[model samples]
Target: MSVPKLLIFILLIFGSSTAFAQHEEEKFDAAGTILHHILDTHDWHITDIPTGTDAEGHATYTPIALHLPWFFYSSRDGFTFASGTESLLEKGYVPYHEGLYPLKAGVSVAEHMDDHGHLEIHMEEEAFKEAYVDEAVTVIDLSLTKTSLQMILIGLLLLFVFRGVAKAYQRREGQAPKGFQGAMEVVIIFIRDEVARPYLGDKAMVFLPYLLTLFFFIWFANLFGLMPFNSNIAGNISVTSALAVLTFIIIQVNGTKDYWRHIFNTPGVPWWLKFGIPIMPIVEVIGIFTKPFALAVRLFANITAGHFMVLGLVSLIFIMSNAGENVAGGLGIMPISVLFSLVIFALEMIVAIVQPFIFTLLTAVFVGMAMESHDDHH
Candidate 1:
């Protein structure tokens, strides 16, 4: 064959093989499948059971199960159980559960219990009391849960980094900052001069700790979420909601007497107008609550939406290839998908920094509004 023909043949073979491989991988690449595996299964530590019998010996040697950081098992049809034999027959393989009972090739007979097992039963009950109370539902998986761990880790990291910086400064005792200390000093000053001073003025120092911590903590969490193995804790609604509530509380607690009086009882308004102005106060109160709600939703939605979009784009390749005839079409779309992924990745970097800034800025604005004094110059 000529060089051109050989090249064409090679391309055809490579393309055909890649298509087949991708088709197989696509089964596990569905929207939530990869995420579920990562969140639930990846680095999952499973304890092994002993296979061999002990000294008195029904079976002299039992199979010993060891804990593994990673293991793969299909949950498609669900797990199984067996009687006496320690063999589990699933997908034509005899797999051991907990390294002991060989799961029989069938549906699991074991009843699923909630994390707490407060409501333990085989079947659902109609009566209120009999109904599975699902204690597990309320019992949060603190270790497995993303938000708690993220917050704890972020807080610790901030303290460590800040502490280190402080120590470095103390050692230098006024000399120019070096290395990490210098970098952090620059960032701290920038935030103080650019972010805090401009917004909060001299009183900005009062909120400096909170503002700095909030900015860096959020920025770190956002960046962490973008890491391959890290969880999207800030993207979680509950976490964002808590942060929003904190901001709301601060705004309310720090509100000046003038602020409250203006909302509850407008000073200059005529008596008849003030008495009739029931709707304004209601709207004003609603607005107060809505501000924090918007803050929470904005941060949560933006972070979550970015992840979903990236996942969706990657999923498109699988969906199209699974359609069979669209091999060429899918191949054609790969570059576009990759391009968009790169773009989004870059955008995410900006968002990582920008989101915390926006959050802090809005927080300061809200605080300023609440503490605004008529006596002070505009």
Candidate 2:
């Protein structure tokens, strides 16, 4: 059979098996069970307790709940805090559910003055009930979340790398670039030629650093999301929204006087038509806002969808296991999962690089449009 025919046969077999596995797994809710195991078993370090056996053959206290690493935590009450790690787990406590972190019920020991002396008070879990805590806040808002720290470090490293390259170029004058400088020179040159110059003209150099930074940061973040136990920083809508807002700001601020005037006052139109022409400008302004919104949503949706698809595919095994280990299920599903994962991995690599290109390309297009001069045509 032809390659296409073979592929189609494989897909049909894979799809049917996947559906059966999902049905089997659904009977026992294997996906939920597995998810809970992964999420809950991970420590977020809120509080710790001791519960191990002692040398005297009696129950002894051993440190638990030592290090809880959480993304974000907030309370409906006035009190709020973001720490490097959840501190409550050092006492040997575990998360209430499998994958859900109770951000609000964070407990800490407090000192209170009493008649005898200083007393340590353990805040009851009920205290948080009245407090109304929300751990679902944006990971970016979390104090020293691993993802946030990684982004910062990535930014600083890129800065130093680029700066060093720039210094080398300056010192070498007209000589050929070498070492790290040479490697970066090639990339910068590609960005200028392929991405920036095609859209932004001679003035593109001014925006090169911003474009480079935006591309590398986002690309790296997306790649990082694929790592085991890593947070999906780029997959989060807020991060993409912030990037879109920046693009919006740049497009508006860099807009020339003519750009605005053309919107408000058309150069060639009838007296009656002038009034109607202004509507075009209003629409144009709205378009500017919509462009960035589209950018943000597109990136976030694509990244997130890819992740969900991969997870769903991987979950097939546990689902099929419920049906008495039918060798057909494992024989069928594992190869499909492996195959699709490889394909998706390749796509992700392309996406990591392509997303940045599209973002920077659009930003450049907007910037170029803002800087256009009608009179220059004459």
lDDT of each: 0.62, 0.62
Q: What is the lDDT of residue 257 in candidate 2?
A: 88
Q: Candidate 2's residue-wise lDDT over 1-378, tens digit each?
A: 235434543553465556547676344453443333222233333333657766667654443333335433323322234322224233212233222233334543232323333232333455532343344442222434444555676678777877888889789989998998887777778888888888788888988888888887887777876665555666667778999999989988988988787666656645455475456666666777799998897787666655655665666654555444565776678888879877877877787778777887888888888888778652
Steric overlap count per candidate = 13, 28
lDDT of 2 at 151: 67
TM-score of 2: 0.64
Sequence-dependent TM-score of model 1: 0.65
Model 2 poorest 10 in a row by lDDT: 91-100
State how far residue 221 of model 1 sits from its true place (Å).
0.1
Give the Cα error of residue 175 in candidate 1, in Å. 2.2
Which regions of candidate 1 fall more than 4 Å away from where they truly are? 1-144, 267-273, 323-332, 376-378
Q: Which stretches of candidate 2 lie over 4 Å from their true place?
A: 1-79, 82-146, 163-175, 178-180, 266-282, 323-328, 376-378
For candidate 2, give the lDDT.
0.62
lDDT for 331 in candidate 1 is 90
